[model samples]
Target: MHEINWLPFWLTIKLASITTFLLLLIGILLSYYLAYNRHKINTIIEALLSLPLVLPPTVLGFYLLILFNKQGLIGTLWYKIFNKQLVFHFEGLVVASVIYSLPMMVHPLTAGFRSVPKNLIEASFTLGKSRLETLIRVILPNMKASILTGIVLSFAHTVGEFGVAVMVGGNIEGETRVVSIAIYSAVESMDYKTAHIYALILFFMSFLTLLALYFLNKKWKPYDKA
Candidate 1:
């Protein structure tokens, strides 16, 4: 029984959870807007949302590294306001994770929103309901499973994130060292036992999370017969 460092594991979970929560909130709104709006700007927004899917993670991470550098536009402003750098910290990891997993969170949500029948949405609005009310009471309720699916996917993907964290976070122990990066370190140093343990843990956790999500969606979609 190799004594495991549970700190990195827990910190990774915390990072992933916070990242997923923020992505869920922002992704849902972004997806909704993209699904419902046909403005020319929406196309650009959608393209940016999907960029992570096509771009290599390392490239994305490198870009983020530059973007969050001390002299970068938002980075300099943020540093002056908060007296803190967004690079080489847990907060930086969160930002990288969010960007890396944005598509995972947004695509499913966009699909879910689009899946909602237009007639039902219109019917809700016909009853003197505002667009917001229609979204809250009708469209969203119908796509609960899809939203859940997106959240689960985002959390699972963020948990297993490696390149973005490493590139942006510097893999500092107890700071930005997430489980995936820790496992890589363990492997490189010939700490096979810990590496295997972490790998197995991540594999099983992701599998179980996805299984639960699918089963929950199955339970709901029985009444939503196509």
Candidate 2:
């Protein structure tokens, strides 16, 4: 058996965890707005947000690379403030993963928010609860399944990232080298055994994630009906 480098696996987990957390916050806010707002521009905003779902990872990564290059706007501003490069670092990987996995988080949450009964929200408002309060106490409680699904999907998507992670973070061992990059490296070096192991790990991880999501949704199904 080929000796597996576990560092990349751990790093991938850390990246996914952080990215999913951040995405949860951002996704919830965005989904809330998209659910409640009826402006024509919301369609445009949603389309922009969902672009990553259809866009090629390499294409997105290439643009991100340019945008975060030392000479680019974000990079220049970050350097001026922190005196550090953003690209080719773990931070960049997190940013890329968040952007890449945002649709997975937002889409599900948006649907969940929309699935919430309007009269229930109205009743909460009628009782003098603020929009934020209604969101927290009413909308969210009713959509626990969607929330779990979004979180799992975001984490799994981030863990499976390859092109964006590589393009934004590069292959810096013990730093930016995640499992997807490690698998690519193993394959490039014709190390089939290592590649197989990595592939199996990711496959099982993704499968289990989805399986757990479905199971949880099933368990929560009765609550949602109530």
Candidate 3:
């Protein structure tokens, strides 16, 4: 048995978890905006959010690299605030992962928000509930499948990220060397055994996560059905 340094795997999971959590929070408001409000500018906003789905990872990562550099807008502001550079750091990976995985969370959540009935929302308002209360007490509870789908997809997508992670985080050990980067490093060193282990773990883990999602949705929908 080749002794595996599990730090990369641990780091990858941590990144994915953090990204998914942040996306969930952001997606709730963003998805609500996209789903309920129709305006010319909303189209532009959604397009920007969805760009990562079509943009090449290296292209997106390159731009993010520049943006996260110490001289870049976000990076400069961050450096002055915390005295830390975002590039080639774990923080960089989180930011990159969030951007790269945005559509995965947002699209599903937007769909879920739209799936909610308009009357139900209005009724909540008529009953004197605020929008926030309706969202919390009504809409979200009804869209369990969409929420789970977004969470799983974002988490899975973040796990498999390679180009963005490499470009932004630079494969630093224990800090930014996620499983995908670790697999590439292992293969490059002719360490096929290590690479195979990581690959198989990812494959099975992703597969199982998806499988559980579908199963839960299938069983959940009938119960959640109005």
Candidate 4:
């Protein structure tokens, strides 16, 4: 048997961890904002955010390329201001993955936030809690399962993300090359054994994450009902 490259595996975990953490914060904030607002801009932003779900990864990556190219608007501004290039790097990968997996994170968070009872929100306000306090103490506490679900979903989605990462991050070893990209390279080289190994790891990790979610939700069933 060929020896496994633990580097890609560890890098995948790190990328997923960072991406999931940022996505969790952004997803929860977006969900909360969407839940409380009925504005037309919210609808438009929500539609745009969810657009990644239906769009092909290659297409999305192409647009990101244009958007982050040295001559591109955002890229030029970033470089002029901070002397940084945005493409073919870890930062670019994170941006791509976050955009790609946003819907998976946002959908679950929105569902969870919406599930918070109106009575609890009202009660918190009646008890003289501010809006921010009510969200932190009342709504978020009630939707803990959903929040956890969103985090797990975001992390898993990001770990398995390939096309966007490859197109934008360019498979730089020990930098932007995640497990998914490693698996792809293995297959490209006709290394089925190594590919299988990486694929199996991803499959097992995803399965276990979902299994934990299932049991966690079941354990929280009574609280959900109450």
- Provide TM-scores for the models: 0.94, 0.95, 0.97, 0.94
Please report how far candidate 2 places residue 183 from its true position, in Å.
0.7
For candidate 3, lDDT tens digit of each residue in 1-226?
5798899999999999999999999999999999999999998998999999999999999999999998899999989998999999999899999999999999999999888889999999999999999999999999999999999999999999999999999989999999999999999999999999999999999999999999989977853456
lDDT of 1 by residue, 105-174 (tens): 8998899899988998888877899988988888878888888888898888888888888899988998
Error of 3 at 157 (Å): 0.3
Model 1: residue 22 alpha-carbon error in angstroms: 0.7
TM-score of 2: 0.95
Could you tell me the lDDT of residue 60 within candidate 3? 98
Instruction: Give the root-mean-square deviation of each candidate in angstroms.
Output: 1.6, 1.4, 1.1, 1.5
Relative to the unseen true structure, what is the C-alpha lDDT of residue 167 in candidate 1, on a scale of 0 to 100? 90
The C-alpha local distance difference test score for the whole of candidate 1 amounts to 0.88
Candidate 1: list runs displaced more than 4 Å.
223-226
Each model's C-alpha lDDT?
0.88, 0.91, 0.94, 0.87
Worst 10 residues of 2 by lDDT: 1-10
Task: Return the top candidate by lDDT.
Answer: 3
Q: Give lDDT for model 2.
A: 0.91
Off by over 4 Å in 4: none
**What is the C-alpha lDDT profile of model 4 across 1-226, one tens digit per residue?**
5898888888889889999999988998898888877898988998998898899899999898888879887678878887878788787788888899999899988988888888989999999999999989888888878888888888988998887888888988888899999999999999999999999988988999999999898887666545
